[model samples]
Structures are given as structure tokens and as C-alpha cells.
Target chain A: MADPRAEILRQAAQLFAQKGYVESSLNELAAAMNYSKGAIYNYFSSKQEIYDAIIIFTLTGLYETAAKAVSEADPPVERLRQFMMAHARFLADNYDCFVTMLVGFSGMANSGLKDDALALRDAHEGLLRRILQAGVADGSFREVSAAMTGRAVLSLLSWMVRWFKPGGGKSAEEVAQEYHDLLVRGLLA
Target chain B: MADPRAEILRQAAQLFAQKGYVESSLNELAAAMNYSKGAIYNYFSSKQEIYDAIIIFTLTGLYETAAKAVSEADPPVERLRQFMMAHARFLADNYDCFVTMLVGFSGMANSGLKDDALALRDAHEGLLRRILQAGVADGSFREVSAAMTGRAVLSLLSWMVRWFKPGGGKSAEEVAQEYHDLLVRGLLA
Candidate 1:
């Protein structure tokens, strides 16, 4: 395995998403992992740690992927689209982690990790707002409250985790394009 | 208590939302209800039963509320907006059950109840798609794929469960209006 630790998190994420943090057990995770029950403990001490890792890894990775896509793209409108598409692509690639990050973690025991995860989520929101602000400043998008627009766009994109499934008809990118069409058309000056 | 059975469901919904389906306990629920553990069992045989009741009660209520608002509204566009606003009101009026309905029931044991819930959810989607279709038919909305537009609108509204809170800056109605503004403007020909 390229990264046994990462593998544990990946396997655990599916377990966590399918069940939940409170319902999941390392014994079950170990069975899923094909590792000794203690082997998981070697990588992470508790399920909470693994969940913390998921929140951190998923949100941090999600933000990085989206930010990179936004930065590589041109003016704000395309960047906004890029941000949504990138988020879709990331969630599609890491379905379990995205599910855990978005819906499965709410009742989780709050800690610095949960705070960190929320901060990363907020940072991603900030990125979208900045893109909207840039779009309006550059006369690409209509004048609107970037904060509210950011929340709306994030809602459309984030809600995908709940509904978008691989081969659930449309690819994540395809769905993202439809959302992008609606959003961009809505925002175009 | 308004209705003892409903009171049980309401208390159970908060417990389910705060913990989760598998993690929640009828004992805890009874404590929340100020009823004995045996009293809870008298109302619902199992946690699964409580969850089933929640799925049935919440989705059926939500769909009916939306359908009534849509039927009572004027044009298709207004109907669509009313559907969303009615949903927000329902969710706000029934916070715990909405939370349980929206995010907490996944991964629960599938049964006729889940199928019923999904059908109700699809019925709601059908209502939205029909509105978009009506809007397009009447030239009140642009020629858009009603299916995709319905999905987008549902995404925008459903995700509110995750973020919208009473007195959390914007009321759910206000947030729905903002989303409605984005959506209606987007679909305007």
C-alpha cells in the first residue's frame, strides 16, 4: 500500500459514512481493513482520532483542490465555475470522505478538530466569496451580495454530497455544469 | 403534550437528531419526554419504529405543506417560490424532526417506511418539476430542463437544514427568499 495510514482513513471513512462515528467500531473497521484490530490502533488510537483525521483530511484537501482550481482558472466567473467543478470532482473521487465531511459529522463530539474542519469549510466559503467579489469588480458578474451568493453557491455545491452518486445518472462534473449554468447565468451582468 | 404519541416522536426526533438512529436510545428519549423507559416502549416498540414514524411523519407533512402552498399560489413561478418558502416554514416549525428527516435517517435499516419516505421526497421533487414545467408552458419561465431545474431548486432548499437556524442572523424564510431570488432570476427568460 502506498500509504497504509491513508488507507485506514479511507476505509474508515466509508464505514463512518455508511454507519456513523458513534455507531462504527474499529473491530468492524479492522474487518473491512483486513488488518488486525490492533493494526488500526497502530495508525490511530481511537475512532475519534480517525474521524478527526477525516474532517481534517477531507476539508483541507477539498479546500486545497478547490483553491488550486480557482487559481489556475482565469477571471472570476470561470474561477467560480472551477471552484464548483473542483468540489464536485473531489467529492466524486472521495465519496465516503465527502459524505463524512458534509453530513455525517454534525453530531460528532466537538473538539479542536471539529473547529478546524469548520474553519476549513469557512475558508472554502471565503474563496467563493472572493471569486464573486472579483467577478463583480471586473464587471463579469452582476452586482450582488458576495456573502449571500457565496452561501447559495456553496449550498448548491455542498448539497451534492447528499444526492450526487457515482453513476447515479450524471457524472459529478456534468451535474456541476448544470448548476454552473444556472448560477453563472443568474450572476452574469 | 399535544398528542402523547406525537410528543414521543418529537422528543425522539431531538434525541435522534442530537445523536443518531443507531446511537439514540429510547431510554434517553423517555427521559427527554419525562416518561419512563417502559412508557416509551408502550408508544414505539423499537428505535427503528420511532425512526420509521419520523420518516413518515416528517416527509408526508413536508410534502403536503409544499403541495398546499403551491396549489394555493397563483402562477407557476410563484408556486415554485411558495413551495420553497413553505418547506422552510415547515422545517423551522419542526426543527428536530426536519433535522432527523433531512440528514439523520441515512444508513438506517431499509424497509417500507424508507421507501415511503423516498416516495414522498420524490413526490416533492415531482411537484417542483411540475411547477417548472408549468412555468415553461405558460412562458413564465425560460425553456429549461424542468428536471435539472427542479433538482437545483431542491438542492438549494434542502441544504438549508444543514445551515439555517432560527435567529441565526437570517430566518429560514429570508434565506429561502434569497435562494428564491437567485433561482427565479436564473430561470427568467
Candidate 2:
């Protein structure tokens, strides 16, 4: 069985994602998790703590997944494509985390977790930027603002959460391939 | 002088965009607008009403701007480029409105304006789909999923609001042109 703390975080993330964080209550989360309110308090002190945990977990998970996807052994272009595919696959598998991150980041000003979330996001963006920079250096990619291009690519992948339905027409892998083709070819010199 | 109602909306949108709609109070909005709370109520019955007005105003403005940007005389590629540029310019010029729309749409489920907001969003996307379909039909663009491609394009454009700093580096036109070149050429046969 998963650790009770981990299970609590997972359930809390799902509830926060489905219902906005503001609307999701600890009682409801406890009900969904089949845990008593006292059980929840043992894992998380407050709803805000639960929300902060979700934000940190989601952002860190995304960054680590993408970072692991890229390899120096591959050509920079291939690495970039792999990074994008990893991102899409993560979003597809962790739909709740993706939604939580999106809603959390949008409301960051209201949440005390703003700086940590932004740092995680920036680090993820940095990984993409470095890949683009490498591609530019290797003459595989055209000259473009690596920062802007990285954001553009990240935006493309991140927006998948808004429309990509797991059981819907296109599988995540298929969508990733399409995006890979569109973006990789678009960046080629 | 502008209509008092329109002025109220413009000010409210700015406030809501900077501070979220949920956080922006009528008293603060009235203070920003130099109107008494009573006067604000005279114009908008409630904060929700002000938010609804902002939604209607922003979405309608975006659709109208994009509609006027496309020309029948231009080839499908040029029309697409024009459409993208027009969107970037609109976003840059109407920064507050764009931000308001983003925050509003994210919280649409809680707001009574969900259906209306979705309808406006779909209409805006329809314009892009039509452009992509026209390109595919005319052989200017390679075979692609018009609906998916449309969303992809809009995602690239819409995500600009998060990172685009007006005077920091590239102008909106420059960003738009780069995006046009990247996306339009990617779609080219």
C-alpha cells in the first residue's frame, strides 16, 4: 500500500484539480480518500498545506520527468523531441497533477507557494532552453531566441492538458508525435 | 469622456487582471475608479456583473479584431499570418483584457459565465480552424488536423500573455512575426 501521506497528497491533488482549490474542502477530500478528518490532519495540518504540497509535488515531478527524458548521447534535436514527448506523456498520465499545477500557478499570488512554483517552472523552462541552445550551437536548429522558443514549445505541450482526453480520439503518444514533427521540423535549420 | 459603464468595465478589468477577480473587491475597484461604492453599484449591480461585462467585452473585442484582420484578397498563408499578428497585437494592446479573460476562463466553472465564455472561445477558435482548413484545401498548408492545429496555434499565441513584457525585449509585432514564420512555414506544403 502507498504511504498514507502520499495517498493523502494524491487524493488532495485530484480533488483540488477537479474542484478549484478554493472550493475544495478538507472534509470533502477526507471523504474522497475514505479517511477521517482526523486522519487527514495527521498528514496535513491545513488545507493550505495540502495545496502547497500539491504544487510542490506536481512541479517537481514535471521537472524531474522532463530532465530524465533528455540524454546527452542523442543529438540535440532528438533530445528536444524526447523532452517534449516526455512532457506530453506525463501530462496524460498525471492529469490531476497537471490541472493542479495550472490552477495553482494561476492563483499563485494568493498562495504563499508562488516563489517555489515559479522556480520549478523556470527550471523546467531552463532545461528546454538549454536543449534549444545546444541545437543552435550544433547547427541543427535555426537561430532563434532560445528563451522564447523554449516557452513556445513548453506552451504547446502544457496546453495539451486543456484538451487532451485520455480515452478520446488521439492517444497522448500520437499527439506527442504530431507535436514533435511540427516543432522539430519547425526548428530545423 | 467615455460611457460611465464602459469606463467602469475597463477599470474593473485592469484590477481583476492584476489582482484576481475573486480578490478584487468592489470598494477597491471604486477607489481605483474614483467613484463611490454607491456610484459603482449604480453602474454595475455587483462584482459578478462587472466580471461578466469584462468577459463579454474582452471576448467580443478579440473576435472582432481577428475578423477584421483577415482579408479575402490575401492568400490563405498570408491570411493566417495576418490572423496571428493581429492576435499578438490585440493581446499586447489589450493586456488587461487578455489577462482578465485568462483568469476568468480558468475559473469559469465557478462563475455563471461558463457557457458564454466557452462559446466565445469556440468562436475565436473557429476563425483559426477556417483559416487552417482553407490553407489545406488550397494546398498552401500540409495535411493537418484543422481543429488540433487551430488549438495549437492559439495555444502558442495565448501563452504569450504570461511571458511577454512589453518593453523588455521583442515587440509584440516581432514575436508575432517569428511565430508566424515558425508556424506558417511549419504548415506549408
Candidate 3:
């Protein structure tokens, strides 16, 4: 984290999240970092590289959070609850980074990093899918399409970025708790 | 729909949705329409005007769809089902405009249209809120925060724009039905 590379990624992510990947320029990123565009080149050759790196960083963070959430739980239902809470906690803690990831993914459909980004996304969603699949197999949850249900639950979590505020009426965990009840109950036999 | 102005808004919306508002240019719009920049200017003063017009158009369509969904239904549950179906239908029927509207709202956060756009959005969410309120009042739905439940329902429906495809494994209405089942069951008293 002490390296200039991580520093550059952090600054550029906030810039891209606010102005968007397409609209942001190296000059703006450089200005935000208080460095010359030449100095930025020492780390990132172009805006796209920075954007891609930020996405990877964000996704890696999500994967780690989801992993930790489920690693401690022995039951599928417990794992599912932990996963949702972890996802919410991650967003609440790193709101700007999560926002950058969402905005970048939606905007960079034609980018060279599309496949890599999508693979990471699928892997993150896979974590949730595995929990659902395990629950259904063990008779903890009813028979339902894991793929569809996973997307629906993730949508409920991700859509919070659109409206969630730090000091709003409900904390991120509280909102996730409500979503968890609705989803878990619906899946229960 | 026959007027050149309507034609311009349609073309601009697609362009803005695809290339984004900040990166899209008047030249690209004119080229897409096969009209010179001057001709485009005759119909619209600036790209901002065209962008604002498209958001208004999309929101108006959403309001009308939500209104018609509840017009004939006497029960809150039926109205809620109709509301979800109508939303899916609207998105299926007008995917690009909806995408354009989503993109425009995100990008133009600092624009002069922010207040107007938010008012429209709140009114649209109000329709769903009223249905939830009525359902809870009559002991049809369980006691829950109408505002939070409405946001959750809308999130389930709105997030479809991110992943819903015409020829996908499930149609928009099918997805809506599954979502309806999960939600209605969760809310049933």
C-alpha cells in the first residue's frame, strides 16, 4: 500500500467514479494526484490501464470479503447471511471504490479488459451461487434456479449503491438484513 | 413521432446510452441522423437540451405505465402484480430508452435537470409505495416499512435493465413472475 502504484489506483478510482472512465483523462488524474502526467506514466501508461487496475483491485477486495464471510460459517444458510452482510459491509466501508467498480463495468463494455472484468464478476457471484446450491442440496432451501436467484439477490445488494447513504435511516447491514430475510424465507421449504 | 424533433431525441438517446453523454458529440448525433449540425441545432439548442428531453420522455412513459397498471385492480396484491408486470413490459418494449434514461440520470447528476429528474423518480416510486401501504393497511401484506419495501421491490425490477435480455433463458415477464412470487410470498400475512 505504500507503493505509488496503489496510491495512483486509489486516486484514479475516485476520479473515474465521479467523472466516469470515458470522460476522465490522465491530466485530470495527474492533477488529482498532485503529480505530472509524466510521473503517472511511470506507473500507468494510459487511462484504460488505471481503470482496469482499479477494477481488478475492487473485484479482488470483493472476493476476499465474500470468502471471509463464508469461511466461518458451517451451514449454508449461515454462510448466505454472512455473505450478504459482508457484501454490505464492504460497500459501506469502501463506497467510492464499489461505485467506481459498478460505473466502470457498465461503461467499459467495449474495453479490452471486458473478459477479465466479467470473469472476476462471475467468480464473485459464484460465491453466492455456491451457497444457494449447497442450501438446496441439503434441504435447507427449496428447489430454485440458483443462477436466477443469485442474480436477484446480488441485484438487491448491488442496487444499494444507487440509493444507500452512510447516515441514512438504515445502516447497510440493516438493509442487507431485510433483504436476507426476504430471500432466505422465500427459499425455505 | 413523425416530427424531426422526435426523431432527434430517439437518435440522441441511443447515442448517449451507447457512447455516454460526456463522450458523445453533436457531430456524431448529426451523422447518425444524416443531418448537418446546423439542422440539428434547428431542432435543439444543445446536447443538454436533447438529453433532458429524453429523460423526461422516459420518465413520462414510466409514470403512464405505472398508472395504467393499478387503474383496474381493486386489491393491493393484484395491483402489485400488475405493477411489476407492467414495468417489465415497459422495459422489454422500450429497452434502449430505458437504458438511455438510466445512463443520462447517472451522468447528468450535476446538470440543471437534477431536481426535475428526482421529483419524477420519487413520484414513480410513490406509486409502488402507495400499493404497499394499502396492502399492509388491509392486512394483506405483513407489517413492514412501506418505503423500504417499495424501494426493495423497485430495485428488483429496475436492476433488470442490467441483465435482462430479450432472447435469454427467461423472458422479462417470466423473471418478473419469479420476483413477484418471492416478494408476495414474503409479504403475505
Give the interface RMSD values of the models in order: 4.6, 4.9, 5.0
TM-score of 3: 0.92
Off by over 4 Å in 1: A187-189, B187-189
DockQ value for model 2: 0.32
lDDT of each: 0.81, 0.80, 0.80
Q: Which regions of candidate 3 fall more than 4 Å away from where they truly are?
A: A106-112, A167-169, A186-189, B110-112, B186-189
Q: Model 1's lDDT to the true fold? A: 0.81
- B1-189: candidate 2 lDDT, tens digit per residue: 469999898888889887777778999988997889999888788888788878877788788899899996898788888888888888888888778876566655567776887788788889888988888888777777887778778888887777786777888878888877776554212
Model 2 per-residue lDDT tens digits across residues A1-189: 469988888888788877777778999998887779998888789988887887788788889999999898998878887888888888887888778766566656667778988899889999989988888887777776787777778888877777778878988878878877776554212
- Model 2: how far is A131 from its true place, Å? 2.4
Query: Which residue pairs clash in candidate 1?
Result: none
Over A1-189, each residue of candidate 3 has an lDDT whose tens digit, in order, gives 379999998888778767767778899888887899999999888887787788877778887888887864488877888899999988887787777776657755657887877888889899989988888888877777788778888899888888897777889999999888776654212
- State the displacement of the C-alpha of residue B74, model 3, in Å, after optimal TM-score superposition: 3.3
Sorted on DockQ, best first, the list reads: 1, 3, 2
DockQ category of candidate 2? acceptable
Root-mean-square deviation of each candidate, in angstroms?
A: 2.4, 3.1, 2.7
Error of 2 at B119 (Å): 3.8
* Candidate 1: fraction of native contacts reproduced: 0.46
- Whose TM-score is higher: candidate 1's or candidate 3's? 1
Candidate 1 CAPRI category: acceptable
